[model samples]
Target: MSYMEENLEKYADPEMYDHLHEGYEVDLKTILKWAKQDGPIVELACGTGRLTIPMAQKGFRMIKMDIK
Candidate 1:
């Protein structure tokens, strides 16, 4: 199978993906620190909005996109 197909099969279940990636906050701090606070931010491959939600709560207008 192609790499894309393999990846899709591997991450088909959102719940399982989330569970597997839980407690993954290594990039949160860096993103928050560098991201502009005044307005919109676009996050590519934003899986289930894990980081997007928190940034939104912090008053950022988040634009999220994911392949799922």
Candidate 2:
């Protein structure tokens, strides 16, 4: 497995994972926004950076990471 994949193999806790994803403010509009721009951002243990993604969509660079 990739180093990234290996590291991320741990955030797989169903209960916590579900709750985290449930907390993000995500939408198609936001994704579209990010698709049009570029900058630097990192969603460490990202679990869905509801805000991070939208911001990234709005033309910022970003990297996504998760802890296993």
Task: Please tell me which predicted candidate would have the highest lDDT against the true structure.
Answer: 1
User: Relative to the unseen true structure, what is the C-alpha lDDT of residue 27 in candidate 1, on a scale of 0 to 100?
Assistant: 94
lDDT of 2 by residue, 1-68 (tens): 99977976666565676575675455645655555443466666666565566566566677888554
lDDT of 1 by residue, 5-67 (tens): 896885688889889989888899899989997778999988788899988998999999987
**TM-scores across all candidates?**
0.85, 0.39
Clashes of 2: 9
Relative to the true structure, how large is the alpha-carbon lDDT of every model?
Answer: 0.87, 0.62
The TM-score of candidate 1 is: 0.85
